[model samples]
Target: MLRLDDLTLFTRTAELGSLSAAARELDISPAVASAGLKRLEQQLQVRLILRSTRSLRLTPEGEQFLAHARSALHSLESGRQALAGGKAAISGVLQIAAPSDFGRNVLLPWLDQFQQAHPQLSLRLLLSDHVADLFRQPVDIALRYGEPEDSSLVALPVAAGNRRVVCAAPAYFAHHGQPRQPEELRGHNCLLYMLGGRVHDRWSFVRGGESQALTVSGDRVSDDADVVRRWAVAGQGVVYKSWLDVAADVEAGRLQVALADYRGEATPLNLICAHRDQLSKPVHLLREFLQQRCAELLARVPWA
Candidate 1:
């Protein structure tokens, strides 16, 4: 029989694509990790991975065995949880990636409460506007806006009804006036956000069966969504952002909604994992907690 530790190492190495990364995660040295993989491969009588100085990839045999390995590990975990009377203590380092604005402004406090509730759990959060490669990166999960394009990944909805909103600070509206329609935005300085090297200057909206998408210019642009939001809050320009990102500001009267009659694009928030087996009990609990918190926050905005 294959050793469970070897199985875990194999899965982690395959998921992370780096022996060093897997070793670090497991708190072992690279030499030990290499020895374990070699032992497993020798027993199986097949080379599982092709490794070089700069790249690593699985063999076809390894690719086929990966599913069975993951399933076996998941089954063992489930059995262990059952042995604990279905209340296994949640204790592990949960590495997560999230959008910059929500991660810093919204999720940081909520995560603190979560950690307080489960003191045994640890967290590593990566905040960025760029999409994280789940297979290549060290993160175990991601909190992202919009549904994932890759249907193979599991996506748990945190806030499905959430959408984008056109907003600006009261001072900005006082000076430049609010754009009543999408077309009028061309005359205003719209704060733009950049992602994956593309500048998002186009704003789209729909109202009463009418749809419009207009490319709006801006005096400033930033790759970080949080920066653009701060610019908007500073009364620098108009901003089109997720309602969740701007909801508190709107409620506090720092920012006011523009084109309330027009419905902006949907931006449903989701918790994404690369594989189903990655959804442990702790992950499920966190998802539920976030769903409740987001619902409460969204409820405060009557127009959203």
Candidate 2:
């Protein structure tokens, strides 16, 4: 059987990327940390890592073993916390990953209140437009928009909202002329989003109970949603985006929603977590808080 101490040491080492770093995190000496890893490798009869003066690299065996070790460590720690009655409280680090736009405009602002409510909890928030691999990364929870393709995760629909109609600034509309039908968008300058250099230029529209999809081409394309919104605001081009993302600009008359009668389907936002038989108190609290907050946000949507 693998020792819990050795597993803990191994996980810390992998996470910190060096014996000295792991030692600092675990409150042990570098020699002790190195010795613990050596003992673990000896017991398993497999070399887990390749060390050099400049860097440490994981062997293929180590990469595979780390997954099992992380899962096991999580289970062991959870079990220990469960057994430690009386003071069985939620007081540990919680890591969350979310999309940049949503995280900035929605979630991050509310974190102050959550932090106040749970002062004992240490929160690590990672914001990126890219999806994070929860199993590979140490993320405890993720807030994702649109439908998730992965069925292995437990997803809770937390918010529902509509996608915005393609819109442009009044100045741009005056210069390019307004598109009366979805097809007319082909003649206009459209701001597009590029995912890894491939244009995500498809615009979905609903009109007279019929849905249509338009493939648009544009001179400017960006991976950043904010950049697309800014281009539309600056009268550079038309942009199809979520209302929640551009509602304030639309309200301020910086941008106008084109093809007004043709709005697409409401996208459901979700909170995802690793599937477990039981959830920890911190996870439970965060889920409830997000659910309530999302409900409140959705209720204020003008198109809802």
The numbered model that scores best in lDDT is 1
How big is the positional error of residue 199 in model 2, measured in Å on the Cα after superposition?
2.1
lDDT of 1 by residue, 12-115 (tens): 99987899999999999999999999999999999999999999999999987877777777668756655666465777678899999999999999999999
lDDT of 2 by residue, 159-228 (tens): 6664656789999999989998999988988898765467877888776778888788879988777778
lDDT of 2 at 66: 87
RMSD, candidate 2, Å = 3.1
Q: All models: lDDT?
A: 0.89, 0.77
Q: Report the backbone clash tally of model 2.
A: 0
Error of 1 at 118 (Å): 1.7
Candidate 1 residue runs with Cα over 4 Å from true position: 11-30, 44-75, 302-304
Clashing pairs in 1: none
